[model samples]
Target: MTDRHNAFLSDMAEATRLTQSGRLGEATALIQRRLGVPGRSPDGASPADASAGPHAVPRLEGPAARLGTEAAAATAHEALIPERLRENIDQMMQGLRTLAPSLRGLVGGGLHAPKPGGLEPEGVETEGGQFVERSFSNAAGARDYKLFIPSPRSGPRPLLVMLHGCTQSPDDFAAGTRMNALAEEEGIYVVYPRQSSRANAQRCWNWFEPGDQGREMGEAGIVAGLVRAICTEHPIDRSRIYIAGLSAGGAAAANIARAYPDLFAGLGVHSGLAAGCARDLPSALSAMRVGAPGAAEPGGAAGFGAGSVTQNLRVPTIVFHGEGDGTVHPRNADAVLAQAGIDALTPRRERGSSGRHSYTRTRYADETGRVQVEAWSVQGAGHAWLGGSPEGSYTDPSGPDASRAMLDFFLGHSLPGGRG
Candidate 1:
């Protein structure tokens, strides 16, 4: 076996040992560090820097090795060893050994094969609006993000905060959703806060980590600070501020909406789990694989911290999920809806078609007839942005336009106290 493969095996063995010794946290952290996952460090250190300390291990090389590392890392915390992990490792090893020279060349060159449709065209600067690169820094840490200001900007415009999925960039997400185009039409300001690869190798928001889940700490605080910074710099309507995301980003959005209900008028979560669904890497994997039970209620004195109580407010929410999604189970959408505190109400269901995808949409309303929650189940869509452009990554072009629907729902709601 190659030296890289040997190192991969060594790390896996060590992680398994650590977990067996009840050092689940350390084992998980080791895996994340070895796999180059970002934001695992507490002091805002880069993964490379954090991994370079005394406990750091050698890095695994090649895509197959990386995949093996992730699988092995995941198995460390399991009460019983999973047969699937071994099977996957064996399959990957055999596949890597048999890979053609041409394919190997492509992999070595960063897997930069041009995607179909070329959604992210080369040399394209801006489209339908202006994209300004900005940074927000506070006590929690500094993060870089992009802000899209539509043309003919006037008045206190509504602000939409969008979080991208794992391994996706703000630009890719913007292209897929075409949110900027819609924002231009509606005269809205859109912000896409990028989750750095230095923070998580997958460029995913660390929503599953307990540190990033609560208010005024970790990533949640940084994101909220970014919002406050934007509002202070621009003429944004605080009462109409909204947040939405897909996958990991979607989960983070839900966490933020839950922790800081007063800051967001509405939230959109597409293929995401409910807030506090998972507090560790193992639980997160379980939640993603099989879906977790929904939270008891939106707000009932039980807050993120033991003593603090979350505000008694429910932000209007919209959820979209594909029944065919293999990455994240469809039941996660149901859990998110339940977390919005809309399970008691009967939903108004409607069947709709967009592009080549058919979907059923259900809306839950309050006693005042205000729609509090909406859920969309796309029949044949997979783990992707519904009705998104093909040019972007992990997007399904056939489903109903989730971006438009989410925006409509967001625009209809405002903070109860009209923004603090």
Candidate 2:
């Protein structure tokens, strides 16, 4: 295997030993410090309130302390990794032999091709909206997309751009989120952009890459260009344009919103890290595990430690995250708000339930009493889309309808002088 993969294996093996010896805290801290993300703790705990060294491991408490390291790590999904590795050792070895030649990507879920398939139908033909397949090419690159036109409208209508997660296509995402159906009801247009496998094997947006993170370049630039083209071709209101996504797609949405503040009026991120949270594969792994280092602090004007959002113009944003998410830490939800430059503002918090899950909703408002940011923290939810359909992958239909909530929030805000 290559040196990078070899190094990762060696480091993880050592971490396994540390867990076996009831040194879970040390193991987590070791990995974080070694990987250059020492701000997070053993159990993906936020470090905003902790006063410790970057390499310091916080002591476990109560039940976790009593259970020792093994149970703790197991509950956190870190312990099963070794077992999974052992079970797939033979296949993994064989794949590793040919991976160097077949795979040109090492990051953004490129280590393996877990989900195998190409494009599928956007939805049933009876869905009522025209889900047309289209393509857009710009100076940066070319991408294929599916646009859902909501019948014929008299005046300009709102438009929403939806980005899919890693290993997901526009069809699966549209089916899962059921956004097209909602678009027909709200009289708004929706678009789903397809990520090319050539860019990343898993079809994940390269949000962790520096080239893709900047304005007017890379993936962000292509997405922005697509939006502009859609606006020019369709009767879309310039004031009410918005974008939302899940996982890697959510990260890309944040980057796109930050880069082109004038193009998008609102942003939505579900189970995603903030833009600039990771610069490469190692940091991306670290951020997904614990969170971006220094994300614990919510009151930062200089963009969280790992992210950089320098625009004085803030894009109104709404965020959703499950507290029990193991793939991406819940702390990342907070980092998203901070990166949007709204975490410094005090929020009005409320508690509610969606029958299946209890959630905490926090809203931040400007001095004029207009809400600029909203966050939802769902309890007992994992790494799936809340209230999404099972027809698509990575969806849990057990929580509040995220599509409805996001649509309402998006409709509530518009550009400074445009119609809301």
Candidate 3:
């Protein structure tokens, strides 16, 4: 093997170890530098801009230095990161390249990176509606959120809580999904909760952690608290609240919705895994690569922390996944559907095209013929918000309009005694 290839492998192994240790910032920094991304310092901060940049990678010492030796390094590389995982690692790094520029502006209190299409910054009042910023704090913790209130507020409006993916901010998410634009059309309220980098270096929700997976705890508690606070302050209908997210955010949305079924009437999970799919970094990577182990067996919901997975979904749910998504395997989408134990034989299927991409949509109904779960599988799309705008990050604009579809599905159902 070439010496250069060996060095690359060594770095890849180290990056994998860092990721397993939950030091994603350092791992991101190392990977970003290896990719030759400009404007970033070795510590993962941008020299020109403190707000956006990669997280710093720390030097190995003592016990950590064993990986520097050829023998120990080989063993660690072989044992911890198998040959099969290399492809996934490469794909993830490539995704980082696309995400790096927007990332510098997203972290800490840095100025937002410039919007691609010269769009207005997030939370700016536009012609369509008023975008307002707010904060919520409870015993669990505190979080910042942006609320999009439609221009014409006639009565109690339905609310949608949006969670952005890693390396994303509320404004970036708003621009990508264009959910705020849809809110203007439907006369509803949309809120995007900002995940702080202090909680996670990449600003991803701690979905794989045991504490964050259950109801009234960790990130779930904070998000639920935010929703309650919004409902109390605004003219929101308690019965018509919903939540949706993408990638890491998507997994979090599943956990939050499942944890607090009483708070959310419906859920939209795009390119996400099932709730409690993984309890740690190793299992999380495994679940993202494949479906959660034993997820199909009866009573397989153990190790899910406080709550066990139930057979039926308490809240109406819809899912979206790209067939070509490399960062997260498409089977995770199936796992999300499988969590509800929907019968495989009953779904009604349809094939359609959204401008450039082809898609297959499957709908599953309850005994009353109410569509309780829906899945959209888009062809040729990757780990991005399908049919999202180019103005934001991590979006593919040519696929099906997931924002609109999710809105339609969410509006179709409400809590009991609610106007559906």
Candidate 4:
């Protein structure tokens, strides 16, 4: 272990000692400093200066060390520390039976850790757009998310919840989708919820986990709480709230929409499976390989519950999948439509080309003539964000622009009562 790792561990031990002695305030401050939050240490020195002093340990050499560094450097308010570190902290706190409730909350709660650099994407200017880092916590869990507000807002604007794929950050996803630029043009607000590596090794949303797939539970509940918090703080048109994601994030988006249909007006999924398509890792892999039949159907053996499959309401959904996507099969898009209770009643087909890739879009509408679900099958495209910028990963700049299409579809629909 490097000196820094040792110092971090040692700091934890010292905090435990302080807590046991009933000096909870001091203990909390120490922990905050160790987390790299800007604060004064007990010795009257700044956290940065204290870390470089003789008592500070050098950085370690391992995954644990890397996690510590990342956790300290993370800007997201709810960014989670490594599970092992969290467990240790929890145990230490437990030993301090007399610690104040608020102090304990600070130690155990999701705290903010500002990123070493700014949260804004590099080389991309929104002109009048603003990016803010925020956190939301509830009984389910806590999460850190970024919100983008476009300039020149005359009234309550629409809100778009963008979930990132596995191994992708909010900044990276924003860059790849170029959604910020679109939001600026449309005067919309965009929010991106970041998944922690501690949550999943690849930083994928726990969509496949039973604990996370339900309403008011796990990741779903946390994200919903975040949405509620954002709406409460911003002048969001509740009727126009929408959610979309890519890959694992796409699957998560489906899960969120299914669980909280009233909260979201529509959904956009890219290269993703339907909700409850898998209950575990093995089943998730199976679902991705050939598509899980009846995975989203009511009362199916693989179904999570009755609520897992949409019953009363059909969330307006738009799906995009590349025919050549090897990571997630194209048939999964059909499964998504089926889960939304959309019937294959003669789709309006449209073909388009961007640079080298061509795509075929088929729109499926309900009896009322409202397009409930649409699928885009990009020819010769792989598993990537269609027409995304090259600055980010998992993007094909040649395919149809998914961000623009999704925004157009989202703005067209609202809740049944139209209550914005």
Candidate 5:
């Protein structure tokens, strides 16, 4: 959305809050941003029929214009709600709430999120010239992946394939997360298989659809194929290979694990849900049925089964989410954890003054108690990558650390067997 539009919504929200909260003067001023004293009722004089005399004049032009301009100033206080003056305020509200953020990058110069430093791979020069932006044709490369590799050493290193969320591109995700530096630091190979608009206008991973979330074919298979191809050329530790993503991408990571339990080593899902629980518009609506803010729609029988991603997922996993997230509910973590059946174990629930909530490092195991599923939670954050670039969406860095945990988790495990 344009800054003007964001400002308009901000005015409406302020006016609504002040009016409801009994602050009429402030409310009036806020509402005036759009209404501007109702344009003087079409009369030449006060309370007269000005249009009848062809001399209708605006009532508060001088002072009211000032009010509109002031109310439109930039502030964190902005909320996308149009004032009552607009006949279609409800329609405007959708843009304010749902569409604005998606347009954030388009409107303003995509500024780096809060602290871009510390979040990226520091002290290292770009390993190879620039990660050659290239693609190859697999079975039917309907979708191609943008590849990024670190200093390509002969020895196989771990591979990290990142999936982009809805309305995002591989380059966008890379620009926001700067994962290339991290790949260089760890000597890891990375692949970002971009989704096409044909699959989704927004280019989302399509993890929300039931048909796309399984191993049958389509995106799921392409992703698997991409991983296999990378493993073939790169020195990726088969057991150590992993996947990670933000929202829909996060859901896809989980879905991939379920479709091919033996392939990936772990997942890093931020602000997303497990596979099966939500697929397609109907199921997505169902998963979001609960009336809680960002809460998971308690699962259905068709959701991830006991031995699926939850049980058979022999790899350890880590999750990061903002406690105050309004997009995807934090409670979905419980549902994702539930699918993994983290029933008996409790990690540690670490927290700080800021809202960062982490799970008690619990292990999901089979009858023998071998570690399988693992997770972490961040508090007081909103839909975002913890300690990620402010340039990205749904990210907050000032809380329980997530970037540190992600790297630690990636380093701790490699493919279970030697290049299995």
Candidate 6:
């Protein structure tokens, strides 16, 4: 393995221990101190925004705090880090400093090979990017995944668990969002869990399939498996871990969040619907308009977080839909909110430019006091990434900086109670 990979694993392993051993607060303090709010990039972008740091992230208090945020540049400095935690994080980051040279990368996913100029692992560095691939087994068989690490100056950095939309590969999703590039600027780690195309046509995850929405058997297990792997293999601050996806991938992501709320700090849904809300495409479409079939009671549609959301967890969420979205109607966004039991609604705030309609966030509170529902309706957007990709389709790069805004939210929330 490359030195960068080795070092990243080491950090994650240590962080995992800290959080699992009930030292989450200490771990957070330790990580924050080491990475120190990431400095600006060579071209002068801005400080690397680590996933979970000192920010006003959404707070979902339950057995374990599991909520995140989408706030802007938060003002946290090295001075705020506790002395003891800083010392430990400093020591851990020192050895990995030498592995920066081996952190290059390759963009695009699925069956396509990385291009000639594409990033080469352990070679041409992109500021600094590090990641790890992992997997697990289920009744459906076995599955694998990837966890991109940001070489933070501070550590125990927050993590972003990215779920790819249907027919989309982790590599393609990474390319379009350039989230890894953003990680360099923000000093946060990015985790990309790929859904096997063999499982569904069009390479879409079985989010609409009931088997995938449950806690034990299908897609939910795969997602939970990835989370478990990350917890076992990295120094991810449990309170700061977040999830996001597009299209069917977005729907899968929402399902994962609602099903495993304890596992995700926050969630971002782009061009997708809530899973198990319907059994098929036709029913899924109908549920998107109103509530799930027979879900007419006040809390009828809000029960998706009972297990699949993450071992019966409740976390913050951010949903994105295009008013003109043809594939998945904008109404689906509402269906997602209702099903997740999110009751708060932020006032309508929108802005339009050129061919884009940008709908702002209206916060909805969940039973745990966390903002359960937050939606971003891109009036003219489509069933694709807001930002464009070189080899990826169904993306609109010219639109709002979805990656940036998503990161802002990712950094905004924290895990309830604390993981370490």
lDDT of 3: 0.72
Task: Go through the candidates in order and give the clash count of each.
Answer: 6, 0, 4, 7, 29, 53
Q: Model 2, which residues run further than 4 Å from truth?
A: 1-127, 298-313, 417-420
**CA shift of 202, model 3, Å:** 0.3
Give the Cα RMSD of candidate 5.
16.8
Q: What TM-score, computed on C-alpha atoms, does each candidate reach? A: 0.67, 0.68, 0.70, 0.70, 0.61, 0.62
**Candidate 1: tens digits of C-alpha lDDT, residues 172-198:** 789989898899999899999987644
Model 6 bad stretches (over 4 Å): 1-127, 131-134, 138-140, 280-282, 285-314, 340-342, 345-361, 364-372
State the lDDT of candidate 3 residue by residue for 1-420, as single tens digits.
688765555455545544544445556556665654454553344554344321111111111222333343234333434354546655875664455444423321122332332212344334667766555677777776778878766688899999998767898799989998889999899989888755775677878877887777989998887787767666888899999999888989989988888888999999888887877787877777776765556466666543343344557789999998877788888777876656633699999999788999999987778888899999998888999998777788898999999999999988876532
For candidate 1, what is the TM-score? 0.67
lDDT of candidate 5 over 1-420, digit per residue (tens): 688887565555544433433444434434434644443331111234334221111111111122333233212113322444443543444444455444433332121121221111211224462343334344433454566767756666787878876655677577667677777777777788877544664456767655666674667777887687667665667887888887778878878877776787777777777666654465554453331222233233444454232332434677765556665666666666755555544443333444444433334554555555556555455666666555544445455445456666767766557543
Poorest 10 consecutive residues of model 2 by lDDT?
55-64
Which lDDT values do the candidates have, in the order given? 0.70, 0.72, 0.72, 0.72, 0.56, 0.57
- State model 6's lDDT: 0.57
Evaluated at residue 314, the lDDT of candidate 5 is 39
> What's the lDDT of the predicted structure labeled candidate 1?
0.70
TM-score of 2: 0.68
* Per-residue lDDT over 103-194 for candidate 4, one digit per residue giving the tens place of the 0 to 100 score: 43333322233223222222122358876555556888876677887875778889999998876778778988999999999999999998
The reply for model 1, stretches above 4 Å from the true place, is 1-128, 294-313
